[model samples]
Target: EAEVAQSPRYKITEKSQAVAFWCDPISGHATLYWYRQILGQGPELLVQFQDESVVDDSQLPKDRFSAERLKGVDSTLKIQPAELGDSAMYLCASSLVNRGDAFFGQGTRLTVV
Candidate 1:
């Protein structure tokens, strides 16, 4: 079975530090998404990429967060000057096409102190 790959499954950062997470989607999948989930809440879409282009990022905090898929395969998400409220699970998901069923990776849990 295929799966999405994410690194640094756990992270701890100071209140004003920088952090990053990575994800590699399953082969041939063209739609990738970054989601943030607070412990008791449903995951919120942070960004979405179709191929190498960003198709949606309306909820992404532009001033502190960024995501990219330079080659349309693997992607990276970064947070600059991370804040305490930013602690959450960062999830990466992918589907073979837009609106298709997605497969998710074990999320990166971020803890800010």
Candidate 2:
């Protein structure tokens, strides 16, 4: 059986404010990730975690954007003092260890005003 992920479908916020998006990954999956996509561009990896430990977050803007996989089951991504350029779709994906076919959530589309 297949399981669908979870996240708010959309979000609108003013610039210089804070916003948060959540994702509940498939049960038993050990890997979780957060991605950002600008209009007309492919998704870019923001952060990845393996069982509550960060694997990679070099692309993430540590000053404003933060991601975490709490208890290695659910994840959250937050942006503080969001900028206009930060408006984009935030996607959360999960996969088995070193396996193929990662599943993604509905994605949170953020529009900064």
Candidate 3:
């Protein structure tokens, strides 16, 4: 079984449209993070949640991207008016407390035309 689950393994959308990805992390993990990875580039942090509270979202595009873990069980990432630059693999990972082994989801690949 997968340690984490992500939906819609692949997605293709036109530019200026909207897209969203979902992720369910392993049970009992208290820290969750959202990352975006462009082709040939390393994953970049988008947002982080410690339980139900947001601890970091400095790199997130607040104007067009938003992430939330309301109850801390699962999380969602949404991008409105997605641009070409938003085409990337969105990854979700969870850890014990932000400093231990991280369990990564399969990821959602978004392609903006």
Root-mean-square deviation of Cα positions for candidate 2 versus the true structure, in angstroms? 1.1
Estimate the TM-score for candidate 3.
Answer: 0.95
Name the top TM-score candidate: 1
Q: How accurate is candidate 3 locally (lDDT)?
A: 0.92
Q: How would you encode candidate 3's per-residue C-alpha lDDT over 43-105 as one tens digit per residue? A: 999999999999999999999999989998899999998998898999999988747788899
Clashing pairs in model 1? Answer: none
List lDDT for all candidates, in order.
Answer: 0.96, 0.90, 0.92
TM-score of 1: 0.97
Query: Which model is ahead, 2 or 3, in terms of lDDT?
Result: 3
Q: By lDDT, who's the top model here? A: 1
**Clash count for each candidate, listed in order shown:** 0, 0, 0
* Candidate 3 root-mean-square deviation in Å: 1.1
List the RMSD of every prediction in angstroms: 0.8, 1.1, 1.1
After superposition, candidate 3 runs with Cα above 4 Å error: none
TM-score of each: 0.97, 0.95, 0.95
